[model samples]
Target chain A: MAKMTLEELRKLREEKQEALEKRSIEGKDCRIIIGMGTCGIAAGAKETLSTFLSVLDEEKIKHVAITQTGCMGLCYVEPTVEVILPDMPPVIYGKVDADVARKIVKEHILGKRLVTDHMFDRPAADIIKQDGGR
Target chain B: MHIAITDYVLEVVQNAFEANSTETRVVLQETAEAFAVTVTDNGKGMSEEVMKRVLDPFSTEEGKHPHRKVGLGLSFLNQATELAGGELTLRSEVGVGTTVRFTFDPASIDTPPLGDVVSTFMTLLAHPKAGSLVIERKTETDGYALDRKELIGVLGDLEMSGNLHLLKEYIASQEAALS
Candidate 1:
């Protein structure tokens, strides 16, 4: 692709802005947060993050917000991902490579089902049994 | 140490966000032998005392992290810069802002390559405070500049997935021209 000049960016904005307006005005119902800390970077979080963007776009999923955050102190499981969907407790999935990221979007976000195998932040995920998470 | 020079840059820009910057500019310039990155932020600058220990991994702004105490990003980058015989300069004023510029010698074996800078730029803009950031990237022959506010103005909000994806393509395309 040729370099996108400001004029092209403006044109893209005009084209995409309409599609965006058709989206829910109530705001995003789902959020995908990627850890971009140093540890996360060393662990290939870049690929993980790019995967989420491409997957979400390919799936034509809207009303979803994708963001980057500092480490959640899960360096041991770098490349951590946190997904927050309405009506479900926020879930943090660790050691998420591109494959796991795809699953998180397909199975967790779109499927409305948690990918239990890679789930961390269990206390929050297991809210029904939360005894103050002690 | 970090695998790429861009990795250190991501961390540095994040630190600027934490500093409460309203405007941050990241300039990446590459040459035959060396590549330099200068990140300047109009945020709450550092004190002399803090600046001295900023690279000490053990030191970080208090109350920044409730449970964590160590910040190894810069410390690790320092190691890489030292091994590569690169130049690192950090200047700040308490109420003004901070400017961190570092040049890595690609000729040195210890120096890491400039990897995935386009993604790094996108990631930096993914931060909530990204609207305050701008990236100016240049190689010896070609270059481009991206302003976060301009992107958000056109694409809507960066927080949304659609906008983020669009921004990435726009960035990647610009970087491609520099090659």
Candidate 2:
């Protein structure tokens, strides 16, 4: 791969700006989630995020935004994943291997039905406090 | 330690390879004050702009390959080194190569606890043909070097799965002596 110049990087960012901006969940009925935490990366969360992006691209799914955040405090069950749907309860899933991630895309994301077993059923209030009010 | 040094080394080296490196050299030295590691690679180096943003925990460069998203590995390395009361310096020249240096204070509160070095070595040795990973551990008394190719020649055609168990045990003992 060739080294990317500042101008080239800026151009690329610009090219993707529309898609990225369109996917933000601020006022749209979109889903947003991030994998934050140290253990997540060690467990291949980077790869998981890439897989999500690829799947979303292939499926041509708009109105969904996927981004990364800092560690969510769970280490053991790394490669952790979270899912949020507009007007729906947010779901946190742990120990998310690639297979489960695909399922999340095929079922929870596209089918609009949560995968019962993998969902973290903690109270939203507790999760909010744990996330420092985010 | 929160993030094992050996694992950190492996992850960084892999990142070097992903940057399209042809040759990679790693040096680990323990001085009276700290343990230092330097990884140099002959890969497509980063530009000043990229370097400026590279250290940010959130910066990522989209690549043709979906998995080529940036910052995850490098950011982790940066955080781990800092948590260890260590410092990480990255220097790269476009079309040239890149070098990363890490210095860790052995007696700092944030210094990560060392773990099983052998497991670290075993995982690295498993990827012999990918690139060269040279690990040199220098102590006041003496030091040792583990070259991936040498390990492969010794194991010869043995299945990676079958050999992993035995190799893990052997490396553990060697790391014990080094520690």
Q: Which tens-of-lDDT digit does each residue in A1-134 have in candidate 1? A: 78787779878877876455433335776777789999999999999988887787898887787778888788999899888777777778999999999999889888899999998774344553443321
RMSD of each: 9.7, 17.5
Expressed as tens digits, the lDDT of each residue in A1-134 for candidate 2 is 23333344345545655455544555555554556567788888978877777778788877676767777766666777778765456777877777888889898888888887777644358547544233
Per-model CA lDDT versus the true structure: 0.83, 0.69
Candidate 1 lDDT by residue in tens digits, B1-179: 57988899988888888888989999999888788999999889999899889899898777888888987878888888988978888999988999999988878988887889778888898788764788998899878888888777777678776678788989888877777
Best candidate according to DockQ: 1
- Model 1, global lDDT: 0.83
Please give the lDDT score at residue B69 for candidate 1: 93
Model 1 interface CAPRI class: acceptable
- lDDT score of residue B43 within candidate 1: 83
